[model samples]
Target: MPVSLHGQLVVAISARALFDFEAENQVFEAGDDRAYMALQQQRLDEPAPRGVAFSLVEKLLAFNEGGAPQVEVVVLSRNDPISGMRVFRSARHYGLPIERGVFTRGASPWRYLKPLSAQLFLSTNEADVRQALQAGVAAARVMPQAARASAAHPHELRIAFDGDAVLFSDEAEQVFQRDGLAAFQAHETSRAHQPLPAGPFKPVLEALQRLQHSTGGGMKVRTALVTARSAPAHERAIRTLMDWQIEVDEAMFLGGLPKGEFLREFEPDFFFDDQAGHIASAAAHVPAGHVAMGVAAGQG
Candidate 1:
């Protein structure tokens, strides 16, 4: 029978997002494909260090041991086939059971997400991430300079998400953006019983929940809902998750406070938010990704 990714939690990651390719990427970014290819070829045998999303990918792959694989991690990068050799070498050196990849040279790789049935797509390229999100696959623009994940939770896959325009729709977020805090709080308080509409990442969260329930072998998934909503507005976010029958291990309603310190303490392997400000803050202390959706995300 032909192999299929139908029932798996497929994650499509860029080489730069999965491995520390920033230094190498600088050469590539200089607009010289020949130089970039030569550099990668020269260092083909060298293993790249783990990047920000490395921990999350490593832990998720653990779900496949001694059984039918439930998770699939595929490299979907813009690097040429020659440069991709180093990427594979790096993965093998780290013992990541990743055998699939698509090297698109300098083209956008978002087009391949559909074929992979990707539940999540992480890339350092903003254009690719925006394209993927528009195509209905949960995607995030990884902050390449973000701090690497903490080694404290080796056995657990700790993931955190922002509330508005991430786990929930941008309906309330639009209100907040247009009218300010008072109106946003009042709107959320009034609609505390109503569930917020599903956002781009909701499907990813639901898939994680299912995987958490079905997978075993000493691996675990812990999720957190970290948001800027506070007090009265927090009720609606809680109710929305309750309505969906999804449970998170932690929830932080920080109001307007900085999320970096709090996320540092949480030590999540990956964090996602719609706003660049929150992503900027979290990236300093933990690996962070931008959802690039909703009003807060802006156009283009």
Candidate 2:
């Protein structure tokens, strides 16, 4: 018999996204692979600190506590095999059950997302994240130095996402950015009942929904849709979700207000936004990921 991950919610993450490797990454960035390898080898037994996406991964993995296999997390990274030892050591140190990894030794690792059937890919490397997104996988460039998630929700995984260009197509956002607010509102008003197209992070949300329903005993999953659209425009967004038969626990149609303070109140384990400004705002309050797509692609 062959092994299968067909019914699982699989997530592929980079070594840097899962653990703090910024110091060592600096050496590699300076074009000295030998020094980087030596440094990693020297610190092989020392566990690395948790990075931006750690809490999210930890909470999601909790679903498989009794080995039910509802979730799968793979370390898909460009680190060399030697550095991968440090990653494994760090995972063990933190009591994470991560047991699979692919160290490409400086090569881009996004290609492996296909075989792994990854619903989500989180990495600090923008190019790798871009590749993953281009390949039709849900990906986000996680902020390595962002604040960790709030520990208040110990038994639940809370996630938040932007609306246009994130959970839905950037069509509406393009209209907003190019034609301004009044035109955008009018356009959405005409399409109030039409469901928007799915964006890069839609698969991630779908998988999270599956993980949330697969088991009833572990940490549960709660999600939110945080967008700048309000009023009649907001009606289209809600109608779109209803059209798809998907319901988020919360929805904030902030119009043009800053999302930082509102996100601080929600205290999500992680937040995903396409706009760099929104990422900047959210990063200050909670861990954030930059979904590099749509009108906001180049900035982040």
Candidate 3:
């Protein structure tokens, strides 16, 4: 039976998300002429993959095909004149549905794009995508290489997140980072049983919960919370998930232990955290993303 993408939304991110091109320039010095030519070249028709971004897009298509819902990929670029067309053709050849090709001159492009009833935006650019997310877009953190390497056989899409910054407000994180562990633990313990307030990733998590409910309690997607908080302080985390009414297959309160081992065992497709050390280590195993905290009221 043909898979139905009728209610599924998927996004394939390129350039901005997949690799830090600007950072790469500092390392390899591709220079203006080479860079300009590479950008302008009709490279998609060639036999080999252009880079990790294309590979990620291909994987997203396969992942969609393996599931019950229909999925489409939106190629996101910035003012690339011909890149979108090439991507569209390549995607069509692979039998994946190619939705509109989205181009944005700068960050936060998804804000202007209309929301699909059911959708998931996959990208490696955590900060920019987070902005779109804050504006209510259904975005997921997907690494270009990971998307390519992932199996296409409908394996459960396991996603893990750190509680404070990735899943809930950074208020708790700030209290801890700025004030000190004892004070932070006290605050969380005091409100230990109370639900934590919503943060940037709240909507995205809620959307996944809805999908889980729609699937009749079966595990179409598996989620986990692996954080440094432990024991008495864990109640707040529990209460927050409960309040959201989202079911995470697992929760690990690691306290001060390094998260790499747990992440390896869980084998999540992607893991999100605000700490760079954790992200660096986890990325070596599973795709990892760093969530940027919301800007303060007067920062901009």
lDDT scores in order = 0.92, 0.90, 0.59
Model 2 per-residue lDDT tens digits across residues 60-127: 88898875688889999999999999999999999998999999998999999999988899999999
Ranking by lDDT: 1, 2, 3
Candidate 3 residues 1-300, lDDT tens each? Answer: 964445554454544344334433332234454454365354556422333344334433544443564345666655344545555655566555666666663344555435433344555566556665665554545444432224542435566788876677777877876788899889898988778877656665665565555442133667788888987888888888888877788999998788877888887656767676666666667666555453221111
- The CA lDDT at 115 in model 1 is 87
Candidate 2 stretches greater than 4 Å from native = none
Q: Which candidate tops lDDT? A: 1
* lDDT (Cα, tens digit) per residue for candidate 1, span 1-300: 988998889999999999998888889889888999999999999898899899989999988886778899999999999988899999999999999999999999999999889989999999999999899988999998899999998888899999988999999999988999999999999999999999999988998897788655478899999999999999999999999999999999998899999999999999999999899999999999999888988532
**What would the TM-scores of all predictions be?**
0.97, 0.97, 0.74
- The CA lDDT at 106 in model 3 is 38
**Residue range with the least summed lDDT across 10 consecutive positions in model 2:** 210-219
Order the candidate numbers by TM-score, best to worst: 1, 2, 3
Clashing pairs in 1: none
Model 2 residue pairs with clashes: none
